[model samples]
Target: MSSSDLAAVVVTVCVVVALVALIAVLTQAFALMREFRRKLEDFDSKVGPALSQLADTAEMAQAEIGRLRDLLNIAQKVAGLAESAGAATARVAATPVDKVRSAISVLRGAQTGGTGQRGKAEEEGRETGSGGESTAAGSESRGR
Candidate 1:
């Protein structure tokens, strides 16, 4: 063949080889992209429900925390009221009952005979003897 024709043939063959290589590389890249997209879809299908369930559980926990916070507030209010009431009771109880109880005990002691009734007859006899002396003196004067 002529040198010019041989050169043209070599150029055409080079262009054809480059085109085949480009096609092959593009096909491999397309396959890799397709596989990546398929794995992404599969992950979405498999993991989406679990992520949704996790969100639901978090919401439930938040609601429960709010309820517990409300309960704590109520308990704190009750505790405060009880503390005030207890303080008022302590103040009111600190006085007169003790005085009245001591007074009552003193009165009872007098009634029960301070030394347990041992001096009752002696004390009574002293009062009766003094009266009897006056009467006897008056009777002797009247009789004379």
Candidate 2:
């Protein structure tokens, strides 16, 4: 064939091939768009409710935390009151015991012929005796 005719045939083949490639590219693009639309629909159906539920749970958690804070404040106040009550009770208990000890000291003084030295000596001896007994017991246990 002539060179001009051969050139025309080559141009036609090239145009047809280019058209096929463009059609393939357009078909793939349309398919990808459809797939994206379907995924968006699924996300709306599933994740939308889940997000709303998560928001509700978050709100409830915040409310619960606020309630716990109030409860903690009340507990702290109660603990302070309990500590003060314990201190008051200790003072009250110590007062009577102190009075009894003073009365005992006075009685001991009378019994010991009003000699403060004798009363103090006797009290010391009693404390030493008790301490000695405990020490002896501890030694015996250790020996065993």
Candidate 3:
């Protein structure tokens, strides 16, 4: 063959080889893009429901927290009422005890036939003489 025709043939073969390589690279890029699209679709299908469920769970948790807060408020009110009731009960109970003590002192004065001073003096005498014995024993020994 002529030198010019041989050079042309060589250039044409190189161009064809470069085109084939380019086509191969483009085909691989297209396949990679399709694979990436499929993976993105799969991720959306799986994660979409999970995100929705997470939102629902958060809402439920908030509701439960609100319920708990309400319960705590009710418990605080109940505790306050209980404390008030206990204080009232203590006052009511103490009044009766004080009244009974006063009545006993009055009865002791009547028994002594004077003010309650004689009764107290007599009790002190009994305590000093009886060596820690009960008041009932000392009264029995004294014959009332």
Candidate 4:
């Protein structure tokens, strides 16, 4: 063929090859995008529930922490009240007969502050002691 005809044929072949390459690249890009979309959908199907469960766990933990904070606040108040009570008992124990009514008032006031067990134990101790032999004898007679 003539040189000009050869040049035209070469240019045509190059253009066709470039077009084929462009089509191949576009096909690969589309396939990769489809695979990525499928993977994201699969992850959503599995991970969505897991993330929700984690959120619930975090919410429960937060609730428990709030309860613990309230418990600590109650504990601090009880400790303060107990300290005041110890001071009152100390003063009462040091004084004489006139403080008996005040000591009864202290016990009655302490009864409402969640010291029922301690109060009952103290009552039992008092009943069993030699300091109140007449009340113990009365209880023994009642049990018969």
TM-score for each of the candidates: 0.60, 0.72, 0.59, 0.60
Question: Over the stretch 1-144, how does candidate 1's per-residue lDDT look in tens digits?
Answer: 999999999999999999999999999999999999999999999899999999999999999999999999999999999999999998899778888999999977775664344244445555778645555544454444
lDDT of 3: 0.86
**Model 4, 32-107: lDDT tens per residue?**
9999999999999999999999999999999999999999999999999999999999888768655787887886
**Model 3 CA deviation exceeding 4 Å by range:** 1-22, 105-144
Off by over 4 Å in 2: 114-144
In model 2, what is the error at residue 39, expressed in angstroms? 1.6
- Number of the candidate with higher TM-score, 1 or 3: 1
Clash count list over all predictions: 0, 0, 0, 0
lDDT of each: 0.82, 0.84, 0.86, 0.82
Model number with the top lDDT: 3
- What tens-digit string does per-residue lDDT give for candidate 3 at 1-144? 999999999999999999999999999999999999999999999999999999999999999999999999999999999999999999999999999999999977676664345456668867789634545654654455
For every candidate, C-alpha RMSD to the true structure in Å? 10.7, 12.9, 7.8, 18.4
Q: How accurate is candidate 1 locally (lDDT)?
A: 0.82
lDDT measured at residue 109 in model 2 versus the true structure, 0 to 100: 64
- The Cα RMSD in angstroms, rounded to one decimal, for candidate 2 relative to the true structure is 12.9
- lDDT (tens digit, per residue) of candidate 2 on 57-116: 999999999999999999999999999999999999999999999999997667556344
Q: Please report the candidate that would top TM-score against the real structure.
A: 2
Which parts of model 1 have CA positions greater than 4 angstroms off? 1-7, 97-144
